[model samples]
Target: MAIDLYALPVTQVSGVKGKKPEELLALGITSVGQLLDYYPFRYEDYTLRDLTQVKDGDKITVQGTIAGVPQVQMYGRTKSRMTCKIVVDSLFITAVWFNRHFLRDKLTAGAEIVLTGKWDQKRLHLTISETEFPGQGKSQTGTLQPVYSITGALTQKWMRQTMKQALLQFGELIPEVLPAELLTRYDLLPRKKAMALLHAPGSLEQGQQARRRMVYEELFLFQLKMQAYRALNHDRADGVAHPVDLPAVRAFVRALPFTLTASQKQVLAEILHDLQQPHCMNRLLQGDVGAGKTVVAASALFAVVKSGYQGALMVPTEILAEQHKRSLDRLFEPYGIQTALLTGSLTDRQRRDLLASLQMGLIDVVVGTHALIQEDVYFRQLGLVVTDEQHRFGVNQRSILRRKGMNPDVLTMTATPIPRTLAITAFGDMDVSTLRELPKGRKPIQTYAVTPAMLERVLGFIRREVSAGRQAYVICPLIEESEKLDVQNAIDVHAQLQFAFPEYRVGLLHGRMTASEKDEIMRQFSSNEVQVLVSTTVIEVGVDVPNSTLMVVYDADRFGLSQLHQLRGRVGRGEHQSYCILIADPKNEVGKERMKAMTDTNDGFEIARRDLELRGPGDFFGTKQSGLPEFRVADMVTDFETMEQARDDAAELVRRPDFWTGASYASLRQFLQRENIFTGDLLD
Candidate 1:
């Protein structure tokens, strides 16, 4: 009888007993099926190679006989090195192992073994990383060895043996999820064959083929979930059909201080069209920093208000909320649109009055931080909901705000330029509108990378800029000194700057400060009461100060490209020539690449694309904050082409008449149901 792989516990496998099951469980591997799915993160090729072809730093595997007596040397109290001479393909070479003194007894002269490590051609040496004694029945020559991420007491040898035993027992019993048509269309290996190849591929090409199939499978399933949600949202009939007064919205746009960019106008049109539809406007408005997303969002809010419905704008931070409130208040005052601000810092009585006004329809639009989603905060007729820096809020938080109204239109705005592949995967359920053009009169920020040795010069430059009646910002990665990291801290930097520029005031800001303190500090900086503001990344998204012309980031290499771009954006908002100086001494290639990318171009999209390549999707926007799905094999950067194919296929499949019920899709439906990919009435 065949075993049910998904139901069989991993402990049922040979050697996976006692604490072994618990260790595997830590990796989310509780069932035999899951254990098989735990594919190797990397592979080491142990195929025997010619000695003459090996270079000094080439990592190669060679089979040889122990040619000399092994010598063990003890240096430090707990340090030792065992060295021996090995003969491989009639060529003698030295093999060394560090802190492995026990190997001296086992590595007898004339013992036949397979060794893999970096070959030092100049010294005719092989630093032994792995050893296989042929007499002991462990020969891995001419094969690729799978390397897995293991926990306590789980070595590579044990993991490989257990996996081999599991495959022998239930490999044939593993079921296929994708239909036969897709398998033939994509030229994919069978599910069982792919699993076998992934665990123990005969060649590198076979391993790559196996990985391709798995990546496609994961991406396809993920896109299916996204497509289903999108379909469900589109099918909802309870969405508001707001009266889109184009002329009124146009007039509001015309009344703006500056003319809207062409990109902004195009996106505004898309947003207004969505407002007139019966389905809720589930759209994402993304642009580079300094792009006019707010104007477009304000226009949508105006249209909603003109239709006799209130609007709610939620921001991530109180400072940003207050800034938006002040800007919108100034813009909407002439039109008689009442706007109110609600934040956590408000007093009890103040909060009560604001809630009452919101509930009584006295406020046309409400701008606040997370306070807008409170249960007691009622909206008389909520029509549209706009969230700035949408990545800062979780899906549940956004959903709660949307639920406060009767299918209100949601417009999520972000200054971060999301890559096309990530947008399709992460924000796949929402329609995307991009504004790539900056508003007129905005100058590109001049960015430069300098070493710590040039700190004096940077300070002198900042002094000169401040002397000219302009403000400056100095950013640090940490708020206080840390034992582990040696990067500059905000508090110490603030003190140093105050001492260096004794004539000017340097205000300190960090996340640890209270809201009122931060607001006060920002107020002083905006009014030029403080000539320089020293802070952490809390100012990454703050009230814009056009007078701040110089931004000096200490240890800028410690920051991601997107973050560095955002910090640079704080400056260059005014008419004066702006500069961003990155003070860093990068130690790695990735760190150097970040600095180069920052200094190369001021385009946020290009910076974001490079950042995604450097940091990957998981760290791009933080998975929890951005709601990006985690996949085992599919990478949002390298496997983008495959993702696009999967997205197109999933979109087509979800539209089929028998997508949810047909025999061809029975396995797909069952898999999605068992995995709980589609919840509620999505599958129905």
Candidate 2:
């Protein structure tokens, strides 16, 4: 069947009016085919009719009449309620209406209609004011109805009507993208038939099958697209191969002030192998907070520089860029390697000078945000591109930078730990390196979760830390509770802390503040000018201060387990004994569970596994950043077995590259392109 793409209407439902076929088509509702596919936002079940199944106190749907007049009464000044006696067959029940004046007229005495609502079995009362139509159906066996996405102006009734019309007109117009043989083999429903049953299933079993087939197709097509994307990347681009110089790297390592941990050395070897490979490198470097990822990144930078090629380290924030520049400059300046920082906040002269230096190849290492990849900032001999946090960069932007010249090797660094199983599925195209150990002599942060009642003791601990010449961070649960609710805001907390500790310098930082203002506050804190930094979670990922040893997180029960762990990691970086005090309300069990997870272990990997187990796959440590193919039905946490099967299926498909060719591949490719999974430019 040929699809009349031109005949199909694509009008917004808001402005829809009179149902003239021509007017409907003019508004882009050309045919019944388009109308039937108009899905609903939700379904209301009024199907059940048996009143005996409903207990005396149970709320239910029943067909009855207004046997007696409604008794009305007023409540306070504005509210009123009316209760009417109703009966269905031999069963008697009472129905009540609240603030329903017009209902008195709408429901008259001796009227026969179906009422949809709940009943109070013990009270022998029912709330029968839901609907007048007998639209709900009863299941011989219990089943659930499905709801589709919708806009405010379009209702379930409108959708059902449009769908009915579309089925009458253009139900046969939609062409099947899946091959006939595949459909039969998979026992999948045809597109038109599926739409018919999806809107109006004959049985609960049919609905289940329909949902399973649709969800499978969605997930399978997604996998198919991701495979095609990987294929395009594999077929076209050639990676720059710059093998590690072990002897020179060893010499540099020996000259460092601290010894490298076994974990760090192992990760370096994995990265070195990728750098030496012929394929363009796409690798993720995951380390716990303060696990020394910067040092590992520096080593890769050194390797890039030693190979006579320029390297760039792109961070997500300006403060992080400055921190990286200051730290890298100190380490590399001794080796005569020049490092330059470029951020949006830089003055015109500074930016121009930096760009010129980069163009001239005078700056061997460049560190900045998206500013580094802007078209004007060209590298003379770009070889390596290291992104500090993978989540901040999109695939398109990263690909554009890789296209800059010579297809520079890409390495992405993240502080979020991911389990090995998911890493294989989500980042199948990339290698992985993990630094699971902290640097030697790093103090273990002593963690505790306390209630607000222990405020004085907490204040005394802070005073002791401050009097010892160290600084602390006091973070609120939110930036502003005024905009939201039930969360501690940083602004209010800052004001309260200012009054409580008048002698201490308390500075505020949050998303609401200007970038320059945030930078100034951060600089002051770093320079010890501010003894207390009161802020939101904006400081979770990037900010690094060794001197700040204490972290007091308010409403700690409100944050995620991984987030709580990350916040706790902000401390215990320096030699001094650091502490993280979690101020949580005792009544919150959910919050207590999360806080307990932190006090139990500092291992990010274990915490991540437990988080996945507790919250399910959707809330895993770094699943949001993992970029896994979006699955509507497959729960990564609960459907681990199915996920494993999907991964295996994807791998098998990749191995047989020619299996998805001809018209089959054309449809798959179109689907992928529509979903923005694969770009048309294979080389890019």
lDDT score for residue 480 of model 2 = 69
The C-alpha lDDT values of all candidates are 0.88, 0.73
lDDT of candidate 2 at residue 5, scale 0 to 100? 48
lDDT of 2 by residue, 411-440 (tens): 888876777766655665566788988898
Residue-level lDDT tens digits of model 1 in 1-684 = 546688988887888888889989888999999999898888889889999987779999988899899888899887988889999889889998888787787888888878888888889988888888876875788899899998887899889999999999888888887878789999999989999999999999999999998999999988887786776557566688887888888889888898988999899989999999988888989999988888788888999999999999999998899889988988999999999999999999999999999999999999999998889989999999999998888877888898899878889998889988888888887899999988888888889999999989999999999999999999999999999999999989998998999999999999999999999999999899999999999989746999999999999888899999999989998999999999988575677999999989999999999999899877889656567787877788999999999999998998988888789898788766775656532221
Best by lDDT: 1
What does the lDDT read for residue 57 in candidate 1?
Answer: 93
Which pairs of residues have clashing backbones in candidate 1? Answer: none
